[model samples]
Target: DAGITQSPRYKITETGRQVTLMCHQTWSHSYMFWYRQDLGHGLRLIYYSAAADITDKGEVPDGYVVSRSKTENFPLTLESATRSQTSVYFCASSTSGRLGYFGPGTRLTVT
Candidate 1:
């Protein structure tokens, strides 16, 4: 997979539960990002991992967490889901400094 891919392209979970979205890439890029898109807010970063075991919170990481144990896989977890957390989540990978290849995305709905 030269490009990025996401699992569970769509999801529906109850509030206060935990959910994880998976992402994988074959480029072995140095950067991986997780973003959620809403109606009013555009793509808002939830977290980003630079390399294995090197992750950082992004614009909106309140209820989300991310880890990069391997360069090819970056998974995002929603610790405690809420109605407000429902959105379309996108996973992307890129080299040090270049355009990122985005995954198809995983739409999560919290009810």
Candidate 2:
């Protein structure tokens, strides 16, 4: 309730369907990041926002979209979900981008 949290802890969606995963933080950190964890990739950054209206693409931003309208909210959307996108997604927040606090995570499976 006081830290970071993710909604819909688990999700199952069909290919080509649109899905949105929500991340909310109460700490009001300046930097928020979205990462996808896979077998070989470990933890890959999908997108990150330095501020409310300033966002940037990360290492693997191909199939994912992220937006930060408020300091406490950073939501990631899959415009057209794909099977290859199935992974455990984590939302993290940090003040200096060195050490971050992560949310519980959302496990998404695209079928």
Candidate 3:
């Protein structure tokens, strides 16, 4: 079965602008999370949603926001992109207490 998918596998941009990354999944997992992977930061949670319209701030939610209005979609938006924000973003979904399935991943670079 089709799993999660993320758009713009690679991106480049100048610092300070809005950027929204799209994530979609075919499996109706109830928990979706957004995380950024960095060289030293490992995987930092940016945001997550337990279900539609129910999101909570993660460990590193600053400058980032996410919403899950549909059970199969969770989108992440950077209010103002920055160079420090450049990192590999991943979208993951899972059933409660189960292993998460990750998307292909999106690499964003800001100058």
Candidate 4:
């Protein structure tokens, strides 16, 4: 089974456009997270959900949105993509406070 996966491993879009990154996992973990990795910022949590329909904004939730309607899928959308938003996005899942399993990230570039 694919533990976790992210679609459109690489994406390029113009500034002000809308971009959606898809993430899926086979495990039905109780928690799921979305994070972005940049050169100096390292990894910053963008959003997280404890269960279906139960989501919370993370450290950097501005300009982005997330939803978890199912235990296995969490999708992230950028309302208006910007150059500064270009980064590698990772999706992770875990049980309660357990260690999370991260998916292969999606590298996004906005011009």
Against the reference, the lDDT scores of all candidates come to: 0.93, 0.95, 0.93, 0.95
lDDT per residue (tens digit) for residues 23-90 in model 1 = 99999899999999999899999899888889999999998888888989999999999999999999
lDDT by residue (tens digit), candidate 3, 36-110 = 999978999889999999999999999998888899999999889999998999999999988999999999999
RMSD of each: 0.8, 1.0, 0.9, 0.8
* Shift in Å, residue 75, candidate 4: 0.2
All candidates: TM-score? 0.96, 0.96, 0.96, 0.97
- Candidate 3: Cα lDDT at 35: 92
lDDT of 4 by residue, 20-91 (tens): 999999989989999999988989999999999999999999999988888999999999999999999999
Off by over 4 Å in 1: none
